[model samples]
Target: MTHTITGSAKLLARVRRIKGQAAALEGSLGEGTECMAVLQQIAAIRGAVNGLMLEVLEGHIREHLGPDASAAQRAEDTEAVVAALRSYLK
Candidate 1:
């Protein structure tokens, strides 16, 4: 049930940005930033990651689970997408 991306460059770029955000969070901790500021950075990183996930999920639904696709196929894709989303949320 691996959902394939439709080669959306924008989505790829968002993922790269999320990677950088994660690194920035690590750097903030390494530099001993204030507790509040560090927590804010972490919150921002989480939001960015969620945004990337939502964008990709929307694209998967629109492209892979089209209106004409069978209910079973749509359900399978939905399950895959939800599994990925749940893992990320954790």
Candidate 2:
């Protein structure tokens, strides 16, 4: 819980890389790239986004929901995670 990505250089780097990939995907689409090429770019962006989400989520779980967590804290964390998953699914 005390640990956060606010000062994490590596996590910040991941965000920047994801931003670059998204830009590349948009550029490819705007350039009228072929279907397969554009699809590849889209796939790359999706994978990058998923990777970022997983890194953050895993950290949250390990830090905030570990054995030291109280029952209320575990419930809160579980609800938050479920909400995030529902949103992502939609």
Return the top candidate by lDDT: 2
In candidate 2, position 76 carries an lDDT of 98
lDDT of 2 by residue, 1-90 (tens): 445545378678888998998898889888988999988888888898888788888888887789988999999999998999899878
Question: Candidate 1 lDDT, tens digit per residue, 1-90?
Answer: 134345566777888888888898899889998999989888988898778777767767887688977999989988987888788777
How many backbone clashes does every candidate have?
A: 0, 0
Candidate 2: where are CA atoms >4 Å away? none
Best by TM-score: 2
TM-score of each: 0.77, 0.88
Model 1: lowest-lDDT 10 consecutive positions: 1-10
